[model samples]
Target: MVVRQTVLVCVLAVLAYVGLWALFSGDETETPAAPDAMFLTDYSKATTGSCVKFNGPGENDLGLTVVDCKGSRAALKIGTVLPNTSGECPRGDYKVLRDTRHNAALCLLPNAEPGDCFEIDTEDIQRSVVSKFDCAAPRVNVQVVDVAKESCPEEAELGVPYEDLTLCLRRVR
Candidate 1:
């Protein structure tokens, strides 16, 4: 009887071990997934005519990502790349981004299209950002009439020179 009991115990131990091993073992063909690639743009190295996408909030936020110039995510275009010694962007509606750490600055212009409406900041144009709005919205005060116009028409309230063309803006409110 003792011999039979000892043999039964040994077989049970072997079965338990095999069952546990089978439960823990996963598919051998599966492999650990690779980490996602992180892409960071060095705004200081950005060149004139390159397109960028805003990455953070507020006008002072310099976080930007370089993207395709013709892509849908392109929000602003680099009009001029300046050194920190330049002080500020050229006079006009251009937005200024200063990178003191890299001693670089960028003059940016909104990638706006004709017929697009916007709500501009009348108090501080430099602090204003480009956010397109529906033409019928009550908050929309400015409208883009022509993007590549040489000169704005008499009806246009503001004209922003970008590259070789002029952005003819009219008061919509």
Candidate 2:
């Protein structure tokens, strides 16, 4: 009977030690959760009677027609004025406006008219534009989307026609 009790005690002690080790050693190997989806907004300048063109990182150019232009926004669609693209923007199927000299483009919903422009903060736009335009490299004309009125505050002073705009972009995941 004593031997049996001794053996049972040893087994219980070993189990307790294991449980304590597991509780204290922090052996959890689970990865941290990824961030939630985010949207970045930006604005584009439209030329009168000229369709705004957007080129994807893969060298596909998309054209968006300007139905009506207000102070800073224009209503556009894919079939109404935008030309068919061999390959469309990876973001979605809609018309987006881009600068003639810039690689960054604004993701606008179909038929987005002036004053109907959705508001987006600055950081999101920067991340989205950098991801979409591949601005990580050096290029003669680095395309940058303006999300804040103050982002390019000096553009007006320098005689550049930059405008305040917004965009919505999700995380790549």
Please give the range of 10 consecutive residues that has the lowest summed lDDT in model 2.
Answer: 155-164
Stretches > 4 Å off in candidate 2 = 28-30, 35-163, 166-173
For candidate 1, report its TM-score: 0.62
Scored by TM-score, the top model is 1
Worst 10 residues of 1 by lDDT: 34-43
Return the number of clashes found in candidate 2.
Answer: 7
lDDT of each: 0.72, 0.34
As a whole number from 0 to 100, the lDDT of residue 19 in candidate 2 is 93
Winning candidate number (lDDT): 1
Give TM per candidate. Answer: 0.62, 0.24
lDDT string, candidate 2, 1-173, tens digits: 99999999999999999999988997569887743321112223332233232333321434333332332222222222222223344333334444334435443432232113232222332222221223232321222223233333333211112223332222211
